[model samples]
Target: MSGAVWSYSENESVSNEVASAAADVAKGASAEPVVLEIGAVRAGVRAPGAKLLLKGPATSDVPPEVAAEAIAKASKQLQPAAILIGATRYGREIASRLAVKLTVGCLSEVSKLSADGNALAGERNAFAGKVVAKVSCALPAIATVKVGYYAAVESAGTAVTESDVGQVNPLVKVVSREKKAAGAVDLRSAKVIVSAGRGVKKKEDLPMLEELAREMHGALGCSRPLSSDLGWLPEEHHIGLTGVTVKPDLYLALGISGQLQHTAGMKDSKVVAAVNTDKDAPIFQASDYGIVGDLYQIVPAIRKALASRR
Candidate 1:
């Protein structure tokens, strides 16, 4: 029962997040928490416990296929208690492959993780975030952790250690890596976010909301339809169960109807304030403050209020 608890993520930000989760689980299980670096030590990827450098993949571009092989090989020798991977697109694939390669149980997109006796217990959202189910698996299991639930731990860690996984042949090769769309932004860590939805009349009007976001020193986001259906914004701006999940200090929604799919992503936000023309819009139920008015009129008035303060 007293073995190492490992955390791994190709993403720099999510690496720290996963490490925080692993540190807590390791504490409950009375095991050491280790952050595993795929190819080289990333300066940005800091965690709570020891750092392990797996020196096998030529570069950090180790595909999920190769990452699984390396981690599986290392786990066999280290005999870890559990492996927690960040629940990003790449991390999900790596966790799945590692679980299968090592013949271990795997949990996906679980939050509030803890060590329960000889099992790993976590909460998973179901029914489109309407219901949360408690899930667990025996020791030596693999789990993909939900993001934004835990704050990143940047405390000092033990001295780094190195292990060579030897050579790994990837099932797929990464010939090129291009940046996301032009307007893409990493909304995970944004403290304040003003999101849009179907209520906006035209794509040209988005700048009005964008200006408001800038005045508030917050980022702009959107529900799925604004990006996926209407193409008013890039996919990165989309917020929903299928899109990016965010937990901001304040989420100011304008013209958003507040469907479950959209609210699911930002449910953890500290304060939710929504403005919708429909007084009965579902967003009001989820919001801490709801204004039944037109965003077009309300936004200008709010700006005037802000200006008067100055």
Candidate 2:
């Protein structure tokens, strides 16, 4: 309860975000915020706190298992009150492993976090994101901080302390790596997003939505069904609780039903609009504007309206 708050992430950007969250928690606890960097010390160098560089053979291109081992070893030595990890795929694995190694509780995908005396309280979505639950764990806890909940922070020049953790042989060896197919746009950074859903009907109908997105100078996104079930779009385009989280300025859900799983990802959007044939669809509950009509019919009308103004 009296030690520093620790944070780590494989991605530099996410690491920075976790650092910010750590700093916030540490402030309330009156403890230092420490950043742990494996493989390389790049993220810790820019983080706004003390940096612990765990250097070793296990540090090079550190796999999740190796990174978790290194972190667990470090945690045993430092005995931090709490550890904040970015909730990326690998980060989740690392958090779980660390929790087991340390024999502490772990919270996954927490959007809001704070330090409360000897415990840490976190808020996370539950029941497919239809409900928000407040959860708490005693000190020496591990929690995966949800992405986009906190922005990265930078501090004036801070020194990093390097410690050699030595070599670690991983159980899982990566023989090859292949990049996922890249999308035409990065939906996370887009100001406007036109998302499709199961209502899209077919892959051939995607062009219509794509044209709408292009006309609005936005990117095309989709629900999990479109990407995971139908394969009409790549997984990169999917936005949901299990997929990418986005906070666009304008989120236009076209033919999307607005399931809790899908809305959890884009609920942070500044403005939301939905065009669906079902007037009673769940998507309307989450949207700021609703058009109860067929997207096939509504899309052309919107295009015509925009054309006339031009």
Candidate 3:
């Protein structure tokens, strides 16, 4: 319980955020916070405390299975009180495997984290973001911190230590890697988001929403249906529990039905405005401002109103 806290993420930026969260936990518990980096440590990484670089054959572009093995080995020696992994696709796998190896509980997708006595406590969305559950586990537990929840800390002067974790033969092998198609917008950093949903009718109607987004100085986004089901937009434009999670200053849900899966991604938005024809739509319940009307009628009026203001 008195040991240092460890944080790791496959993504450099996300690792920095985990480091910030770990620092906060360490402060409350009066313990050290250490950032664990696999392979070569990046020069840009800034941890609030110390950095531990794990080097080995298994650490080189290591798959989750191999990386988890190396981390478990290091953790056994370090005896960290808690390990925080970024809640990314691969991160979840690492956390699960580590928890099994350590025989400790794993908390997934935790947004708010804190030190609870000698144990770790966190709050995560449950029931599709409809409820926030407070979870706690014994010391030596593992938890995946939700991406974008904690800001990356700046600690350019932190100490660094390197250790060779040794080679691991992975069960799966990566044959090749290819970059995904880049989108014009990065939804994660967008301050304002105008998201379309199933009600958009057809692919041809997207340009209207795109124009609205441009007028509002925001990026175009869509619910999973518009992206995965209808293929109206690229997968990167999708926002939901299974897709990208976002926390923008303003989220405008146009013709969205507000399924729990969709709301799960944007519930953390500072302000939410929704337009729907159904008065009892679920999106209205989650919105700070709601207009019950057809988007076909409302959108044009909104654009005209903004034009007059200009």
For residue 226, give model 2's deviation from the true position in Å.
0.8
Q: Where does model 1 exceed 4 Å of error? A: none
The better candidate by TM-score, 2 or 3, is 3
Q: List the residue pairs that clash in candidate 1.
A: none
**Residue pairs of candidate 2 with colliding backbone atoms:** none
Compare the candidates by lDDT and give the number of the best one. 1
CA lDDT scores, all candidates in order: 0.90, 0.87, 0.88
For each candidate, C-alpha RMSD in Å? Answer: 1.4, 1.9, 1.6
* lDDT for each residue of candidate 3 in 16-41, tens digit (9 for 90 to 100): 99998898888857788899888877
Candidate 3 backbone overlaps, count: 0
Off by over 4 Å in 2: 43-45, 58-60, 155-157, 308-310
> Candidate 1 lDDT, tens digit per residue, 191-307?
899999888999999999999888887899999999999999989899989999998999999999989999899998999999999999999999999999999999988888978
Instruction: Report residue 225 deviation for candidate 3 (angstroms).
Output: 0.9
Candidate 2, residues 239-302: lDDT per residue as tens digits? 9988899999999999999888899899989999999999999999999999999988998998
CA deviation > 4 Å runs, candidate 3: 58-60
